[model samples]
Target chain A: MEHLDYSNQAAWTRVSGDKQSPVALSDSLAVKNDFETTLSFNYDHTASYVRDTGAGIEVGLHGTANIGNRPFSLNQFHIHTPSEHTVNDKSYEAEIHFVHEASDGRLAVVAVLVQSGAASQTYDAVLAHMNQKETFDIPVDDIMPENKAYYHYIGSLTTPPLTENVEWYVLKQPVTLSTEQINHLKTFYSHNNRDLQALNDRPIISSN
Target chain B: MEHLDYSNQAAWTRVSGDKQSPVALSDSLAVKNDFETTLSFNYDHTASYVRDTGAGIEVGLHGTANIGNRPFSLNQFHIHTPSEHTVNDKSYEAEIHFVHEASDGRLAVVAVLVQSGAASQTYDAVLAHMNQKETFDIPVDDIMPENKAYYHYIGSLTTPPLTENVEWYVLKQPVTLSTEQINHLKTFYSHNNRDLQALNDRPIISSN
Candidate 1:
C-alpha cells in the first residue's frame, strides 16, 4: 500500500492488454456515432440509506441507467483526484467515476470531469460524507450534469486488477465543485489519477 | 400475493413501454449485428457462501461477466417456469434468469433456456436447496452453457414496475436438467413465467 505501483501502467508490465483506460480524449479524433445515444439515468434521489464504500465499489446501491440498449446499475462510485481522461489533451482538477454495471457483468463507467467553480450544493452534500467514513449514499442524480453528450470507447478499469474491455463514457460536459469540495476529495487521495493510456487506434465514439 | 397479476401484462395495462421482455424469438427476424460480440464469463466456482433471496434479486453474489465492454456483476439469479423468451417462437420447458447489474444500475439479463433431459450433477447441488429457502447461491457459472451465441434485444423487466431500457441477452443454447430436477424447480413456481410482449419493431441482435 505504501508504494502505489502505477509505474507498471507506464512501463506496460501491467497493461493487461492494450485496451487500457484514462486515455487522452479529443473531440476532433472522436468519431461521431450515427445513432443518437442519450444516456438515461434514473439514479436514486436519496443516498438516504446507502452504505458509504469509502473509495470502494461493493455497496448495494440501487441507482440505474441505460445507454442505448445497455442497462447498468450503480454499484458505488469514488473520486479519482485530478482527472483521468484528458479533454482536448488537458486534465481537470479531479474526476468522479460513476461506475455502473450491466446484468451480464460488464462495466460502463461514466467519468464526469470535475472542476472547482460555483458552489454546488449537490456536490457539497456528497462531498460532506467523503471524509466521514460513515454509511451514506452519494445522491448520484444530483451529481450528473444536464448535458448527456459523452465520448464512448472500449477500455479497461483504471484501478488495480486493471480489468480490460470496460466501457468508458466520459461526459462531454464537466461538473463543478466549490474549492472546499474539490479539496475535500483531494485530501483523501491527492494525485490519485492514473497515467493516461494511449488511444491505441481505438475509435472514441462521440454521442452527438 | 394470493393472485399473481400477470394478467396486466397480457392486457397491456402493466406494459411500462411499448418494449417489454419475454418476446417470441426467431433467428431469421433477428438482425445480425455488423460487429462480432462474444460474451465472456469469469464466474465464481463455489456457492460456498451466499445469501439466497428466495427467488428474489437482492443478494450480493460476486460473479462477473463481460458482454462487449459492458461489465455486469451477478447480483442474484432466479428461475422462471416454462421459460420466458421463446426461441423460434417456441417456449422451452424452463428458464433461468442470471440477473447481472452494471455499476450504473442497468440490468443485462442472460436468459438460459432449459430442457429436461440428462441429469446435471452441477444442477443437482443447486436444486437441492430450491424448496429449502436456505441461504444458497445458484452457481451461475454452472448455469451458463458452453455455446455463447445469444439473441440481444432492448426490453423491460418481466416483473413488476416493469422498467424498460433493460438489455436482454437471451442465450440461444438450451441446457438440460433431469426430470427430477425440472420437477423440483417447477413445484416452487409452476407457471410463474410472464406473458410474451410485443416485438414492437425492436431489433433483436443475433450474436452469432
Candidate 2:
C-alpha cells in the first residue's frame, strides 16, 4: 500500500482502505484516552429537546450520501465547550460536532463553528423549543437546510492514544446560533472546553 | 439530579437536562457515556469506496452513530470484514463502524446494519475512484449534510478493554447497497471483521 500524503486532497480516495484490525487491544488499556463512542438515540427528525442547550444535532433528521451512500439517519447532536482545534493557539467558545457513520463501517463527521451572533434561522427552531420550558420535540428535517458542502482531512484520535488513521470532514462555513443560545450552553458547561494540544504529527488537509 | 428514565419515550424532554459536566477528569469522561448528534463525511465523500462482502451495513454504504464525540472532530468511516457482533452462536460476514472524537478529550460512534442487496450509489462512487487507485489521504469538508435523527444508547467499546460507559446511537433504519458493492469491499479487506463478545450486562437505551 502507498503511504498517505496528507497534503493531497485527492489522496483520500486512494487511502480509503480498511485497517487489518478493527479494534486495538493496546489502545484500550491506555486509559489516558478517556472518550469512547457508544451511544444511540431514536426519534423523529423534526423533534427538538427543551434541555437541548445549543449542543447536539436535533434527533430524527435524515441525509443521503452522508454516510458513504448508506443513507445515515440523523440522531441527536451536542456541543463541546470551548473548541477542540485552536487556530493559532486560539480556540472558539465552543465547537459543534455532527457525527455520522455508514452501515459498512464508513465514518464521517461534519464540524461547524459556533460563534456568538444573532439567532440564526437554522437555529431558531431549536432555540424556540428550548425556550418553551415544556416538553418539546421537533424533527430535524423540519429545521435543517439542504446544504451539503464541507471540509475533509485525515487525522488522529484527538483524545488519548490519539489513534491515527480516522477520517475527518470539517466544515469551512459554520452554522449559526444566537448569543443567548451560546450563553445557555455556557450555563450548563461553564468551562466545558478542553485546552488545545499540540498538533503533533497530524496532517490537516483542506478540500478548498 | 434525576437519573435518566429509559422506559418512557414522551417523558424524554421533561427528564433530559443539559447534563453537561464541568472540567473534571471524570466529567470529561461523561463524554464517554454520551451520544453524538451530527452527520459527517470523508474528505473524499464524493470519492467512492468498495463495500465489503457480508450480510449487513458493511456490504455497501452504512452509517454509524456509535462514534465517540469529543476532543477531536469525527472523521471518515470504514468497515471490517467478518463481523464484530455475535449471534446465538455465530458471527456475520462483516461489520461497519463510524469513528469520531475531538481535540480536548471526547470520543463517540454510531453504527448501522448492512444486509444483502444490489449495487449501491456509494458502491459506484467508491469503485470508480478505486479503479483510478492511488494512495490514501483524508479531505476536509468532503460531503456533509445536516441530518441529526438517530437512536442513542449505552454500550461497551466494540474493540478492547471492551471498555464500558460508551454512549451509543444505533439508527433503527438502514440503507441498502448492491452485491457488486459488497464484493468490491472484499478487495481491500476480506477478514477485517471482529468476533462479537459478551454484552457484559450493558443496557441499550432507546434515547428517542
Candidate 3:
C-alpha cells in the first residue's frame, strides 16, 4: 500500500482502466433478494489500522454469500467515516464494508451506510468494546437494516493499488446512530473518505 | 514523504489548512525584473527518483531569488506531465517545477509550462541524457521563455504532507517541445500530474 495522505491532492486523480466504475445508485437497479444470510463477527481491537485520515477497525467475520454463482466468504470488515460510496449522489455519515473473497481470490464487498439519528445498540456495543480495546462477538445481522434492498455494481477499492473488478453491494437503507456516537467515531477519524470517482457510464443494479 | 501514486484517485483531495494558498494569476501582479540570474544544473542520472506514476530527475542548481525581501536559494527541480497549476483557469500539456528554499525552510517554486510545437534544444539535451542515464550540464536560461511575465500565488506541493504557505511564480509564457519529445516523456509518466486545485478564494497576482 502506498503512503497516502487522504487529505492531500495526490488523492484526486481520474479513475482509469477500461472497466466501468462507480455507477450511480438509484431505484432503477435490478433487484436480487438472495443476499439474506447470517454473519458472525469478533471485534479484535488490535486488528485496527490507523492513518492520519482515520482509523479502520477490522472485524473478523464468519459467513459467505453467493453472487452470480460465485461464492465469497467473509474475509474482513472495516469502517470509513463520511462513507465512500454514494446513494443517488448523497453521502452518509459513515460506512461499514464487509470484504469477502472467493477461493480463487475474487472479492465482493457489502457496504452499509450509517446516518445520524437514534442510538444503535450494535454501534454502542462496538464502540464500548473499541474504547476498552477488548474483543467481543457480534452478529452481523445486528448492524444491518431491516430492509435488505441493495444496489449492486462493479467498482474498485477506495485505497491504493485500487484493484478493480470487485463486486459491490451497497444497502439502500441506512442504519441509525446517535450524534454522540458519530462524534465519538470522528474523534478517531476526522476525515478518511475518498472523493467520489466518475461513473464512467456504468450501470447500478438496484435490488428491487 | 508519503508513498503517492499520481495516477490514482489518492491524488485528488481539496487543499486545506489555515495557511494562505495559490491564487489565480491574472494581469495584476507587480512584475519584478530581478529574477534574472544564472542557474547551473548537472543531470546526474543516479539522482533520479522513480515511482509508479513517473520519475523525478533531480537537477542540482546554484542561484537565489528575493520575493518580498525573503531570499530563497535554488533547491532542486522536477517535471510533471500535464501542468499542475492553471493560469487564469488555463492549463498546459506539461510543467517544470524549480523548487527553491530559504535558510529558514520557507519554499518558493518557479513553474514553466511545456507545450508541443517547435523542437527545443534544451529539452532534447535533457531527454537524451535521461534516455542514456548519463550526466550533463544545462544553463537554466536556455529553458526559460523570453517573456518573464508570470502568475504569483501561495500554494502547497501537489504531493503529500501538502505543506502550505509556499510562494509560487508561474511563468505566463510557455516553452515548446517537439510532439515526439512530449510523447517520449509521456511514455515514462503518462498520467503523473495532479489535478488542478481550487484557488480557495485567494488572490492570484499577475506579474505584468
Candidate 4:
C-alpha cells in the first residue's frame, strides 16, 4: 500500500476564476434549462468521514453519478453550517455537498439544503459516527431530497486551492432533520461557510 | 463537541510496574489455572480504523467481551509489525492488541500473534480501510483465533503513559496471514514495538 496525501491533487492548480461558489440562488433569476439528459445518482456503499482537514468533516464516497450523459464517480461529501447558496435569497439551516469526479478530472458537486423539522435517519447515522472518525455506512442517496429537482451552475470550490471548472447542483427541495441533530453538527462547525460571491452575470440553470 | 486526544486517559497514568507487556511466553514454565468462566467475545459491528496515531493503524471497536466473568467493553485494536511477544522463544510476524476496559476502569489487553502463511480476509478488510480512517464493520470475532485458550498475566501497556495493572491475555494459538499482507502492513509500520520486558517474578497462567 502506498502512503497518500489523501487529497485530490488536481484541485490544487492555483488558478483563480470569475465563477466562484455560494452565490445567492434566486428562482426568479434562474432560467429553466431542462434538457433530455437529466442528472442521475447511483449511490451505494457506506462512506467514511475524515477530520484531517481544518475545513471540518469530509466523508469519502464510492458511488457513480451521471449529469447530462457525462459519467462521474462520487468521491466525497461535506457540510456547511447556515447553508452556503441561498434558495430564492432564503438561507436554510445547513448544506451538504456530494462531490464527484470524472476520469478526465471533471468535477460535479451535488448539494442538498437542510432545514429543522422531522428527524432524518440518514442524518442520525452520520451524527453518531462523525466524532469516531471511522467509516460507518453513510447511505448517500438518503441524504438527498426526494424531489431531485435542482439548480445548476459552474463554479469554483469555496475552500483553498479554490479549484474551478466544477459543476454545482443545488437541489430545489430542502430536507428536514430534527433541530437537535442540526445543532449537534453545528457544535463541530459554525459559520464555516464561504461568504456569498457575486453571480458575475452567470446564468443559473434550473433542473425543474 | 470538545476536541479529544482519542486515547484512553487511564492508560497514560505514569507508573511503571514490574509486570510490563511483550514478555517472552514460555509454556514449559507456565502454570495451568483453569477457571469456570472462560473468555467470551460478543462481536457484531464493523470497526473503522484511524491513522492519526504515529504508532500506525488503530481500529475503534464497539464489541464486548468477558475474561473470567469480568465484563469489558472493547474500545480499540492496533497492529504491531514483526510481532511483539515470542512464543517458546520463537518470534512471529505481527501482533494485534484488542484493548478492553471494565466499568471500574480495569484494563484487559487480548493479544494474538501472527505468522506468515495463508491470506486472511479479516486482515484484508483492515488493510483496505486502515488508511481511510473511517469506521467500517470490523467483525471483531473473526480477528481472533479459533482456539480460545490463552496465556494470562498482569502487565502495563506497551505504548506511552505505559499504565500498569492491565490484565494481559496473549492467546496460545498463532493466527496466520499471507506473507504479502504482513509485508503490506510492514510498509506502514515496522519494528515499532516496546523492548522485551523482564518476567520479574510474575507467574504466567496457561488456560490449558
- Find the candidate with the highest DockQ and give its number: 2
> Once model 1 is optimally superposed onto the true structure by TM-score, how far is the C-alpha of residue A173 displaced, in angstroms?
5.7
lDDT of 3 by residue, A1-208 (tens): 2433333544544323423233456564343433333322332333232223223555554566654434567766767787877776687899988788644344678888999998877666566566343446554555677776677766766665455546687877898788998888777665566667666545555555
Tens-place lDDT digits, model 2, residues A3-98: 223233223221211221112112112222233322223335444354533333233334433332224444445566565554433456666655
Order of candidates by TM-score, top first?
A: 1, 4, 3, 2
Judging by lDDT, tell me the better candidate of 1 and 4. 4
How do the residues B39-109 of candidate 1 rate in per-residue lDDT, one tens digit apiece? 88776655543233433322234578886555678766667778878998788888878778765445788
Segments of candidate 3 deviating more than 4 angstroms? A1-23, A28-55, A131-134, B1-9, B12-208
DockQ order of candidates, best first? 2, 3, 1, 4
Interface RMSD of each: 21.7, 17.4, 24.6, 24.2
Candidate 4 chain A — worst ten consecutive residues by lDDT sum? A6-15
- How much does each candidate deviate from the true structure in C-alpha RMSD? 19.6, 17.3, 20.5, 21.1
lDDT ranking, best first: 4, 1, 3, 2
Better of 1 and 2 by DockQ: 2
Q: Which ten residues in a row have the lowest lDDT in candidate 1 chain B?
A: B6-15
lDDT string, candidate 4, A35-142, tens digits: 443778887667666553456566666788876455678887888788989987799998988889754344679889989998878777766665465667765555
lDDT of 1 by residue, A1-208 (tens): 1222222322312112456778998988888775556798887655542233333312234588886555678876666678889999889988878788765445789888888787667566655543344456455554578998998887877765466546788998888888887777666556666777777777788887
Q: What is the DockQ of the complex in model 1? A: 0.02
- Candidate 3 chain B worst ten-residue window by lDDT: B45-54
